[model samples]
Target: MNQDDLFIAEDNPQKQIVIVAMTGHMLLDFAGPADVFNCANRALELRGRTDGYRVLVASPNANKQVTNSAGIEITCTYSVMEVSGPIDTLLIAGSNDVQNLDDPAYQDFYHWLSAVDQHTRRVGSVCAGAFALAKAGLLNGKRATTHWDRSRQLQKNYPLIQVDPNPFYTRDGKIYTSGGVSSGIDLALALVEEDHGKEIAMQVARRLVFYLNRPGFQVQFGNLLPVYDHQNIAEKIRSWMIGHLHEPLDVVRLADHMNMSPRNFTRVFHKQTGIPPAKYVEKLRVEAARKYLEDTDSSLEEIAERCGLGGLVSMRRTFLRHLMVTPSDYRRAFRTSLADVIT
Candidate 1:
């Protein structure tokens, strides 16, 4: 059966979503997920149904006013201790202050989190909030992720937790963790889909003017170079590859452009970019093909040739290998969706 046909909406009860925030918390980490759930609730209400979710922001302090990392203040509806039970989902917002983990004032908050985790149906962290979860022993032996910059530190601090930095979000049993700030929206959208269906989730995404779904494990970069220390050489090569996507870009040719031997260039590129030159070139080609597929009426073979994939079959293989979908399926899913015309 086709994947699109499998996403029929079903009846779902209203769910309680509590977003925990503290002073110095990243603003988007709290607001992004809250917006997604709010949008989903609005969509449900528009369809003559009751709200699907009730979102509340909570803080650990009595003041119930938290200052974000950016110095913006937001008020919380409840103190952490006052959030009533049988929670459907509990999301912890991240902060830029790494020292928050060591603050003695948060000890009681951690203990409260541990108790809350026992009754919460689903628990999650946004961005660096994974650090708090790890400190609480909730992420032990589970695969989790946080902001790319903090992934190494999280792994170093908690050796038992598996840190995957690539994906936008991750799920292990009832716990979820998202990468960076915006990924919180992606996680919330996935939760909506899980609780309701793709139909409602898509409605929510459309209302929010966001992608219906960006798979959790999709590579974070396409035309952009991967993180690297030696950025000059990598950037030069990446720019050249993107500009010359329709040209033959074997490692030998790329190496010659850099005035280096193919072997030496390949080794250095891998060291700096964390991916082989061939794989990087393929990603560029696929990115080009994706644009053509989404925006034009070009045939598959034409797009393949234009993107320098050589043939339709080769392009299809590359899309499957990197994107986990066939070229045609991708075009169908993305092109006809609201993403095409909304923005």
Candidate 2:
């Protein structure tokens, strides 16, 4: 079905939502999305309508309750083998226990998961659940994310998959993946918005007392400056860049500060950060400009100068290149509320 067909407005057809849980699963990873969908059903019922979703929890082991990472035991409604679909969305919950993709014990479960994907309309993972999806070969060539700590491992393990560590959630075609624990709520909200209208999703969010919609592209980590443990020379240079964003910092200036040649500085910086020096500088500048746009009512030119983007045109282009949105639009979307602003 097309994207339009996913939305259920008046008729409110029941969508089948299957959550796959495993041993050592993160409770919130499964429960967060469960709460969102359950609340969405309640919202529908308040309008004298039937529930829009049929939620089922399934597990690899059918006979016993699965013990989560938190030591909570939860019973599954069905085993993976029995949960044949017409599934609207199949979500795999994360686990704390490190997974080995090539382990013989998981081979059967992996095969079952791969088969289930064939019949599911949309398949996704919450946090480190991405490991299982990658193991099943479902995430190959797809843009995906997991917890911040696990993203590098995911990328290293599945070289074919594009692992983006920053987003709250990512969707590439019919596959989706979310970052860390609470981001499952954001992913679920996006799914609700996709399956119903924005109004229903907003109602669900309000009921849950959560942000209505945090765009998936929003940065997962808030620090504009890179964190370092030992305060190495490269880290010191990065700290200087953050403090001196308003200056006209070029390769020569940065190299001089580090007392190294421009070529050597660029090479070492890239080695330490996995990004080129120029790109890192642009990222920091854009991140600083983003905060200014969200928090202050400064003119674009003023923000540009303060964030060291040189001018308004440069800032605009940087914002577009890095964030895929204009500064004005980002401000409109993420600006603090008037009530908060007044206080």
User: Which one is best on TM-score?
Assistant: 2
* Model 2 agreement with the true structure over 227-246: per-residue lDDT tens digits: 65555555677678988999
TM-score of each: 0.65, 0.71
Clashing pairs in 2: none
Error of 1 at 13 (Å): 12
Error of 2 at 3 (Å): 34
Local distance difference test, per candidate?
0.81, 0.80
The per-prediction CA RMSD against the true structure, in angstroms, equals 8.9, 6.6
Q: Which stretches of model 2 miss by more than 4 angstroms?
A: 1-15, 22-27, 43-51, 60-88, 96-108, 145-152, 164-174, 179-183, 189-206, 209-216, 220-233, 287-306, 324-343
Model 1 residue 316 distance off true place after TM-score fit, in angstroms: 1.5
